[model samples]
Target: MTRLLGGIGAQVLAVLAAVGRVAIFAAVTLRHLVTPPFYGREFLGALLNIGWLSLPVVGLTAVFTGGALALQIYAGGSRFDAEAVVPQIVAIGMVRELGPVLVGLMIAARVTSSIAAEIATMKVTEQIDALVTLSTHPMKYLTVPRVLAGLVTVPLLVGVGDIIGIFGGYQVAVRSLGFNPATYLQNTVDFLEPLDVLSSLVKGAAFGVIATLMGCYSGMNSGRGAQGVGAATKSSVEAASVLILAANFLLTGVFFSA
Candidate 1:
């Protein structure tokens, strides 16, 4: 019993320490954001890379996912002969949950790994130090722009994905599931409240912050060699993915629960 208690206590302490570090990093970054010698050029590049480049992947993923979701819901609903609800269910699910979560995870996999590895490689090559020598603030030049871009761009990506996914579901339902095209669209429009879309976009913004923050943190504190760069890349992706899922749960609770 004592050993078990000690183990539990150690775990709790470790979690607290990790939270403290995140809090400190957030506070420092927020301070710099307000007092920045801003780098508009890098920020624009980050915006384009993160937002525009991410669009194709997000759209393709959404289309396929939404179509599949409509089929599954129809199948399950048919088990009770309630197949008429497919359009409504698909719209609600895609707008409220699937859109944000899928986009978030995709960005976590692609963007987080890329940012972490790129910055980690820079760190390993002493390029970060060289920036300092050139009177550049590494935090502002590197981390700030990426973070800001993620904050702004990811929500747009999520919104686009959400719309595409819904349309995908509509297409599948109408053509494959024998749903009346006009009726399906009417049901979808009638069922989806404005709040559902709003909740999705808000969740996207939260996920964006988590994904970019993980990448930037790992990169800024990376070690000095190949092994270190690899570790940073791995850790950043892992952290971002986990955080995306966890945030989804919390956001759902907030949006749907009394």
Candidate 2:
């Protein structure tokens, strides 16, 4: 019984310690963000990697999700002869929740894993140490650019995903479900409030920060060798994905739970 309790206590402390380390990492990243010999070249590379390269996946996911959502809402609404609500529901659903959340998860799976693996490998190869010996701050060079890129570009991705998702629903509704094309488009536009869109973009920004930060943090703190890199990559994606969902829940409450 004593051993069990002690184990539980140790787990709790470990979790808290992890949280504290991430907090400090984030704080230092923010500080570097403000004051820097800004690395424009690295930042641009990260921007391309995190944003432009991510579009196809984001668009595909959003479109398919939107279409499925429309179908589900139509099927559900049929029970009450409320099929006309499909457009409104789809718009709200995509913009308010699904769009940002899905995009964030995709980014975590793709970008976060890539970042972690790359950095971890670099660490394993003593490249990070090389950076230090060359009078470079690894955090400023390695972490700041990626985090900034995520911050800047993820909201844009969310906005794009929201639009693509709404378009997908529009296509499904008008083509498959006998909704008037004009009316479907109008309803989607009319039903979405500015706040819904704002919330989505905001969630994207938060998710971006979490995803990139976790990847960098895990990579920097990774142990040694190939096993460590693999572990870091896996953990970075897992942490980013979980944190993004949690942040979505909290942000939704803050924005909508009036």
- Candidate models: Cα lDDT each: 0.90, 0.96
lDDT of 1 by residue, 1-258 (tens): 999999999999997997788778778777777786999999999898889999999999999999999999999999999999999888999889999999999999899988999999999889999999999988888888888899999999999998899899999998999999999989989999988988999999999988888888888888879899989999888888888999999999998997
Q: What's the lDDT for residue 256 in model 2?
A: 100
Per-candidate TM-score against the hidden true structure: 0.95, 0.99
| Candidate 2 TM-score versus the reference | 0.99
Q: Which candidate's lDDT is highest? A: 2
lDDT of 2 by residue, 1-258 (tens): 999999999999999999999999999999999996999999999999999999999999999999999999999999999999999999999999999999999999999999999999999999999999999999999999999999999999999999999999999998899999988888888888889988999999999999999999999999899999999999999999999999999999999999
Q: Residue-pair clashes per candidate, as listed?
A: 0, 0
**Candidate 2, poorest ten consecutive residues by summed lDDT:** 183-192
In candidate 2, stretches whose alpha carbon ends up further than 4 angstroms from where it belongs are none
